[model samples]
Target chain A: MNASITPITMPKFGLAMTEGKLAGWMVRPGATVRAGDDLADIETSKITNAYESPAAGVLRRQVAQEGEMLAVGALIGVLADADTSDADIDAFIAQFNAEFSAGAAEEADDTPPEPSVMDVKGRSLRVLDIGHGEGDPIVLIHGFGGDIGNWLFNHAALATGRRVIAFDLPGHGGSTKDVGPGSLEFFSSVVVDLLDTLGIDRAHLVAHSLGGAVALTTVKNAPSRVTSLALVAPAGLGPDINMEFIDGFITADRQKTLIPVLSYLVHDKGLIGRKMADDVLRYKRLDGAVDALRQVAAANFTDGRQTDNLRPVLETAPPTLIIWGKDDEILPSSHAANLPDAITVEILPDTGHMPQMERSEEVNTKIRAFLAH
Target chain B: MSKKSYRQAINEALRLEMRRDPRVIIMGEDVAGGQGGTSGVVDAWGGVLGVTKGLYTEFGPERVLDTPITEASYIGAAAGAAATGLRPVAELMFVDFVGCCLDQIMNQAAKFRYMFGGKARTPLVIRAMFGAGFNAAAQHSQALYPLFTHIPGLKVVIPSSPYEAKGLLIEAIRDDDPVIFLEHKVMYDDEEDVPDESYTIPFGEANLTREGDDVTIVAFGRMVKLANEAADKLERQGISCTVIDPRTTSPLDRDTILDCVADTGRLVIVDESSPRCNMAADVSALVAEEAFDALKAPIRRVIPPHTPVPFASVLEALYLPDAAKIEAAVKAVMNHKVTEAA
Candidate 1:
């Protein structure tokens, strides 16, 4: 096989997908494509997601036809040099399929790491500990009603050579649903307890949305325990927030009602797919899930506004960097404004509140650079 | 995002709900062991198989209550507590013990809302371990879901995997009506990637584990896994099958089952319970009555004999509807030649 020939296979969207249908191909068989190009629409039980091209090449034989259901990692199309012969492509396809099945057999025998539940101050917390290195450990904190899965795209990217841990706060994910007070102090304390449980004295904090407030409070209480802060579209910097999104997120139980509500969190409304809404609804249906979310909303987002203000923390906070989506609808990008002149703020355009998810590649690059320094 | 055993998944659901709502409480015999012991150590055992382990430690004694072996009194108290505002999750250690508390569940809790003309709500969940495999023998290992399915105003849930267990258990707790959540004792150690977040799989929706064109295999709970295994093995020999897991029995997903049968024109049911008047029989009747025209072959039911679940491992293996039996049933239905009625 030539080094230039690349096999474009089915991509796994979320943790739950086992197989998906090749809904359609974006480019024709002979069309030239580049890396990161939208190659095809892969439809799974959860959502219809666009499969991106992995490499730049002339689209060769479409091994798997459109509308065909294929398992994860199954070859859907082949990308090869225009000069490659038709006979060679056929031989390569056979060899690749054989090797792919062999690899799958080995994977079936391997045991992958799973997320674990941790007992922190009596609350059952879900933690995802990934990577290992000599640098100060990094902790990823999700926003309100968000779990460590929110960092799905960026977790492994930033954990290249350092230990990175992400956890779901109380009332979120597999954590205990009780959100006592749901205040910045309560959340910050939980973060501190988790860090202490992990035996980390000081670490870089990468927090998003409501987690931004918790990070601010943690630095205010025990500034020594934090090495640095990377806040992404974080709360606590301003008072104005999209209450519509908050209330809609709390009340929207079905997919139809939720898609519009979640649209406020992204620049592209199309990103609010059925699967995303279904996932959120499923969480809300859990016993006491809605009530706990109500407490958090009332405590933090009272009177149609953010309840906490940690602008002062920005003055004395350890080397902090702020990344905000220029089109953030949940928290205004203006919060990124009026910040200390020394703090480096990157307001990404054509993105929304969930820049970490919408433009994960760019967001991860900024975060990795911030952490390295 | 991680692998969690069926035991851990259920424990997480109970703990999350208990913490989220002060009204949610857990009661069962030795759910929290070490009650009134000479050592004075609290939370001695968390269920007979430790499925509820660590819950008592987190929720403490007030929320995680331990009851005596008397099933009637505790189960009645749970029903009462649920009616009076508390969302109680009472454990009936083994499903066989339901005979001791059937009145509280069937006649009282299940009928409260309807009897009161929709004024009353009983957000109660009775979780019990069912199915045979463990040496627990005949009395302790009964797949008694059909008994509860016979009752009205009651939701019957039979979770197929760790993911289903967590989601469906949470849904049962949040539901306003009485829910009978049955767990397979043999599946406690079965692990799968369950989301750390609390999620609920809606009731009455059947999950198609595998979609095929040749035959349709409808099964419930542990049998769903077996059907999937059979389908995989059959696919290798050019015979394909679709496996369905009707997550809830009462709000049974008739549409999914009928649609699959209609598509394939062949049906095979694998039920773990006794042969007489079982889920397999019920489903077979449903298809015979409703989708008869769509059928190209007679429906085949792979079930154990009406005899009690045997004690010996060999007998138990023979008595259960396994992958091999399901495969044979599918082949039989596939090979069946339809004859005109004489």
Candidate 2:
């Protein structure tokens, strides 16, 4: 095996995923792929997602057969240079299997780190804080009706060099459902309280959809505390909004109806799986969850129009990057238009409101590059 | 989401629903001991297995009523309370013991809405421990969900995992009609990632735990886990299996079953109930009737033999339908080749 040999392993979709099934391989043994090419469709407990290649290389060997169930980090395939000998590839796989089996005992007991509940201002917030590098940390704010798990594809990718903190706002996920007044300022103040509670002096804010408006409000309320801003299909820049999605999200309780409601978030309707709809239904079933969502909708997007127009906050805002899916249904992509030339904007085609999830690679790359400055 | 045992999930569902609705109450033997016994009422054995342990303390004795050992009396009282106003959740302890109270459940609770011209609503839930794994003897250990599922106007729930238990139990409690929620006795200690807040899984939706191309394995309750194990082992041998857990039996998701059979062309039903008159027979019949053109091979059913459950650990284990048995049954159907007309 040459030093260029890169083994393709099972990818964990979320914090709770322990193992996944290789539903099928998208490429043949000798096919070459780019770094982010879809290699296989991995079926987890929650969804069936395309597993992307980690590095650019020629596919040397398909170590794991299609339909095989493997734990996270189990070798599924091998990628190497075209010139590498087949003998060397076989030897490399033998060594990899030897080592994987030896470590299997310790790995059996390896539990995925879970999101913990944090007490902020007498209310509990569910927080998933990852990365430990010494730099200004990044805080992720999900849009209305989303939780920390929505950042499954971006959290670890963006956390390579600095810290990334993803949290469930009040009335979402495992967080306390007492979203006081459900005002943008109330949500923004909770962000301030969270910063104080975590004892961070400065941090980057990356938000999507309604969360973008909240992040902008936080920047306006406490300017010094924020270092940068990255918004995706954000609200608060325009008065136009999709009330159908907002009302449907609060009302659709069954899987049949909820999938259609969630389909508004992405361009690929296939991305809306049964498990995804089930998870939303599960969250909605929690006590006070629907009421909290209703309150937020009534306060922010009152009468089918956005209540706040925080575009003026960009004048003095720190380095900002805005990425909007051109096909966004919840909030019009046109909101990203007419922004100050000083702020950067990237419009992604064939995507929807949740560019962070639908096109995580491009969104993460832009956010990481924007925050590097 | 946090890791919660099947016991904790059920407990949380009951507590949350009771808190949310003042009309919801719980009654069962030893559900709240210490009424005349030694252990504190709040801390006594919640149900026979400590499933509702903390409810007595929080809701006090009034809501968490500890009833006498008479299954007929308490179960009848629960049905009556539900018809009047209160949403009552009564524990039947062991499902086998339901034989003594069949009149209350069958003739009374299950018939209220239909017999009363759809005017009276009976919001009653009967929770019971079922399925055979431990050496709890014949009377204590039996998979008796099929019995209640046969009755009319009854929604029967057999939750497969901790997450399913919580959501399905809450849905049962809130339902306007009568529901029989069966929990596997051996799975109380089984843990899974369950959300803290209350959620309800609709009664009729079939949850496909695994999807594949070769075969569709329909399982219920404890057998769902075994079918999953068998499916994983079969996947390694290149026989991919799609495992479906029909969360409710009374309102069985027949569309999903027929649809999956149409796709896979092979059906394997794993039911823990007795070989005769079991869900396996029912599903096999449905596929034979509606999906006959889709069938590439004869249907296969994996079930326990028609005999009483034994107390001996080894015999009981043999009496149960396990992963090995299910795997064998699946492979047998896979091997069976349909002869075509020449």
Candidate 3:
């Protein structure tokens, strides 16, 4: 009943996750933690992601033990002032459990939003469209061989106060596997069409890697409809790329072979697990996926050099915000150098090609402040 | 992805492959069902257990042929068709019936490419139900994967779950070599989340179901699930284990097995087949020969005794290796110690 106490529950990463295990607590009961700090390691079948603290306070109690599995939204710990009485904390936990078990979770509408197949320009693209607002809606575009799930960490956090759309490109995820032409120009048209199909006129384009090239080409082709561009570890600004990743992503189908290839995407190779390779392999085995990937690779990175230079588009670009991981191996973060004076480029250390995921809270905060102005 | 039973998963794999490729066909005894039955044939039954329930209606009799009850003739015909530019998925009804068609599979189909100087390709899949459970006595129940595994040219697959069933079946249908796809009869109703898209789990790779530090538990087919359960139960008592499911028997994941043994220094193998030359003995020999120096304890096997599958429900339960039996085997291995450190 005390307004000062904030219960730390399990975090749901994706749509499919229902329960997670408290792999271990990163902080003890008496440790003071800030919001967005690592509180514990919560693991699902697919991944073991850090559970961030929701409030800045001392950890008063740990309700769930290490390795204990609990459903999403189940209380795992408590954050409150150091002087909060132990008896008061016990009463609070009792009341919380009673309310949670007596239909509060059912009535709270805590279920994560699900992605659905939407017909865009004669192709079926799986889209997860959530949040709602009047400000320019945000759209996320993942890189090569990526789906809407690539935005797993940032999508929901950034969706606050504005409608955000993350969708699978053609030949990726649950989308139609035919990627027409597989060129940045062709993909740019699809992105523009997707925006039109969603009735999103003048929206923020938050694109990554190959999707960054698409965003640039979209601005070059149709400039009036774009409000701003947030490119993360983007392409089209450089002449160099890690061809090993592109080549391996197409050829390596086995988990043992693919794990090392996926390690190139992250700074911490420990995060690269079998489930990630399995998921990619599952998508690759679908009918036209490999062919589409090959075509995109050929068009985008021919002989390891960037094919289309959309850097010139920046001279007349919209409000641009470029975020790159300093440890990015796929696309060198050095490409963010010598940008236009008006552009805001942020380089995050200790992250890789996927800074949106590896440093989601920081990226979300930057985008929030960037848009607030 | 959604929860699909083993029966549904197999049917979907067959359906997807047939839709993708025109050369694929299905032939077996009662595969189309209702052939020469009390009522007129209308593709009513899918198979003996209805695993192929709806393919007959979708593809029609031209592709879904209900062959004469003779396993020898139909299996031979399937092999011949496969080599002559058709991908035929033939059902053997029960693995015990393989005795009737062993020559066709062992000699003709498996050796087609090699026998003909790498000229002939037999994309043949022979699906059969195996394992002893639900009172399917000796005549109908047998885990005959080792027989197929013995043949060099044949690829033997034993899927553990619905997800594995769908992906492996699709791979089997597409593979150029002769594939013996064994489905445990009791698993048809077992359910798990299987993807809707067509996918393939490559051969010769082991899936580690549980990873731990104390012992390595290698199991086959249904035993993989049991090993996982045992590992979970053992974890509470501080005996951690790493459970491995090799998925395929013929082109076994030897490296994964050897690596696990080298790490844990203890091994427990669970196989539901008759004990003589089953996977347990085969893998036990593998670890003993290659990674002998890494052993801290002797390897343990939780397999059925060398006897025919029993007829009574009570006897059959005793004949099969359960999770409790696997747990006991693991505990024994964890406790075994060698004073010499050899």
Docking class of 1: incorrect
Candidate topping TM-score: 3
Per-model C-alpha lDDT, please? 0.87, 0.90, 0.89
Tens-place lDDT per residue, model 3, A74-120, is 89999999989999899999988887778655655665777888899
Stretches > 4 Å off in candidate 2 = A9-27, A31-57, A103-110, A239-244, A267-270, A302-305, B34-44
- Residue B243 lDDT (model 3): 91
Locate the minimum summed-lDDT window of 10 residues in model 3 chain A: A103-112
Tell me the TM-score of model 1. Answer: 0.67
Q: Is candidate 1 or candidate 2 better by TM-score?
A: 2
Better by lDDT, candidate 2 or 1? 2
Every model's TM-score: 0.67, 0.91, 0.93
Error of 3 at A351 (Å): 1.6
Reported per model, the fraction of native interface contacts reproduced equals 0.36, 0.71, 0.43
Query: B154-265, model 3: which lDDT tens digit per residue?
Result: 9999999999999899999989989999999899999987868888888888888888889999999998989999999998777889999999998999999999999999
Q: Backbone collision count in every prediction? A: 5, 1, 0
In order, the TM-score of chain B in each prediction is 0.97, 0.97, 0.97
Q: Write the per-residue lDDT of candidate 2 for residues A1-373, one digit (tens) a residue.
A: 3579998988877667788888789999999999999998887766567788999999989988877888888899999999999989999999998888788777787776678898998989999998889789999999899998888878988888788999999988889989889989999999999999999999999998889999999999999999999988888899999999999999997776788998888887777877788788879888789999999999998889999999999999999999999998889888888889899989999988888777777788888888777
